[model samples]
Target: MSSIIKELVSDPHSSEIISLAVGMPDPFLYPLDVFQRILENMPATNPSDFGYIATEGYLPLRRTIAHMLSSNGIETTPERTLILSGAQLLVLPTEAGLNLEILEDYLIRYRPKLFYTVSTYNNPTGQVLTEQERRELLLLARRHRLVIVEDDPYSQLYYEEKPPLPIKSMDSFEGVVYIGTFSKTLIPGLRVGFLTGHSALIHRLALEKQYVDLHSNNFSQWLINFYLEQGYFEDHLNFIRSEYKKRRDSLVKAIRRYLENNVHFNVPGGGFYLWCKLKGTITSGRLLQEATKCGVFFVPGQAFNARPTEENEFRLCFASQPEPVLVEGVKRLAKALEILQKSKTPRKISESFLKPIV
Candidate 1:
């Protein structure tokens, strides 16, 4: 999928080809000037700024994260938040660590074990776990002495209504670990993200990070802090939200008007993807091949699932393409589907019957 996206990007005529393929905010929406200004203002501080800082991340960035989370109702101390490269790294190891911590906590509490998660809009799906579902899962986790790892990267890109609070906010038992990233909301190349959890678990993870990168990019952290402190980050996020929502609307409208009923998908509230399930006589692989012929591409859903199945599905990212391009891409996809449907033939199978021994 990455190679396909790369090929699309490398093609001189790629702009004419609509790409619902790659995940990332449109370049037009980036806060380039803000970032540039921050970079331009960087002072030649101690050699350590160019060198390694703390493994957990620079103190200012960690404090900023704590303040940001606190404003959203998550009371995270700097000690309980460890900066990482991005949310993916923050989530994977933290999830593994949470599993161990939960087991140990459960053994001490003499309780059963449980783990609840949103694994759909999960990465490529773009679906957020609903509020009621989140509450119910938290209740179950609490009852069973389990931990909830709410890996929310796309929650802030909603099309309608405000985003829900992090599940960590509802953790009376301190069983929720929330991971967030600037890669999606801010700039991808910055590689800045953080996680919130109990101090003990975070401290252990910080030690683990010490062996990894020693710390996240101090210059990047300083740049982010500078941007946020200057009050440009929120404005930047607002711009991104507006642009992404517009693009998402365009993709949905185009799909509804041009595509047939053979394709079905959920319109996510926020995030970068549309999880499409093909119906009747079409496979994702064939659809992809046809789309490629038309110079369009998307990721097949099997890559996101732990256990691959015969399900015919693919993910479409709208945030990476403009409205006109997305519409054109969807049109290409609709045309491909029509072609595939026309080429399919029905097969009849007869069951052999043995007459009763007469």
Candidate 2:
């Protein structure tokens, strides 16, 4: 959430940080003019409408999201959908997808109350759970009587074929709590997200949420619902999808051209990150030190793991920067890697440069 990268880049703050660290959308792409128009022309509301509303968020917004989810195959009613932004559990992934055997093993041993995951274009790693995996996972959860928190913020940003229907879309057990956010899909500033699950569970969660903000921002919820209803979101999604794919491609090309075999990375089909492994003996911390000197920064993979066994991994986000900037960051990252390889003594980042994140 330290939006230091885009904020500093646009305004040219004194901070010398050129961050590829954060996993947020570029501010430049927000449809500000359209937002202003939506506001200026918004219909008036009652005085109470601006005050405390339902803790589950604006009713219209919930219904709107319900319809959207149903159309996408995750049949849910407004009663089962709650508006909010949210996160949990770490699962080590494989090239094929999530390691189902490991998760089942963990479940059988621990019988954990909740299992959380990103079944599509997962953050940091960009791995996805195949349809088979999703179905099998649902069965496992059902057998264990365990609940799943499926965080799916990046599915809409796919560059390849649309990923398999969300696990929630196929949750016959009604145990998958599907979470989505407009923060990535529509507007970040709004900070609006939605969760759909069992109606009883949603009510319990909503009751707990009541003490937090009393309710989500009424205005933002109303606006987003209108945005969806007027069909503004589809066009916006198409625009971002095209642009982010270009940035992803640019970052991939830059990494290969500069870093080459010094590092190993997975080229994600979508999502914002390029999860990389340091091929040499250098740890991510040492490389970050060199990278910082080069005016680039990334979150080390260790930060994402609770029980990190190695320090050779790191994450780079591609959605936060423009194509040229992504390439430039990668170039700087390559320089840092080079500096790390060549010198034990701390050295300056040569004037030349170039980097991504989850």
Identify the candidate with maximal lDDT. 2
Residue 242, candidate 2: alpha-carbon lDDT: 94
In candidate 2, where is summed lDDT lowest over 10 consecutive residues?
A: 348-357
How many residue pairs in model 2 have overlapping backbones? 11
lDDT of 2: 0.78
**TM-score of each model, in listed order:** 0.84, 0.86
> How does each model score on lDDT?
0.73, 0.78
Q: Which digits, one per residue and each the tens of the lDDT, describe model 1 over residues 62-109?
A: 888899888777888887888888776433344634677755664564
Badly placed stretches (over 4 Å) of model 1 are 5-17, 43-47, 90-116, 119-121, 345-358
At residue 238, what lDDT does model 1 achieve? 84
Please provide, for model 2 over 1-358, each residue's C-alpha lDDT reduced to its tens digit, 9 standing for 90 to 100. 2354445433322355666777877878887877889989977666676788889888889999999988779999998988884322223334487778866754664454888889888887899999999999999899888888899999989998898899999898688989988877776668788888888767766765776667777888888887888888889989999999998999889999998898898789888888899898888867877777798877777777767457788888888788877788888898888877787764332211112223
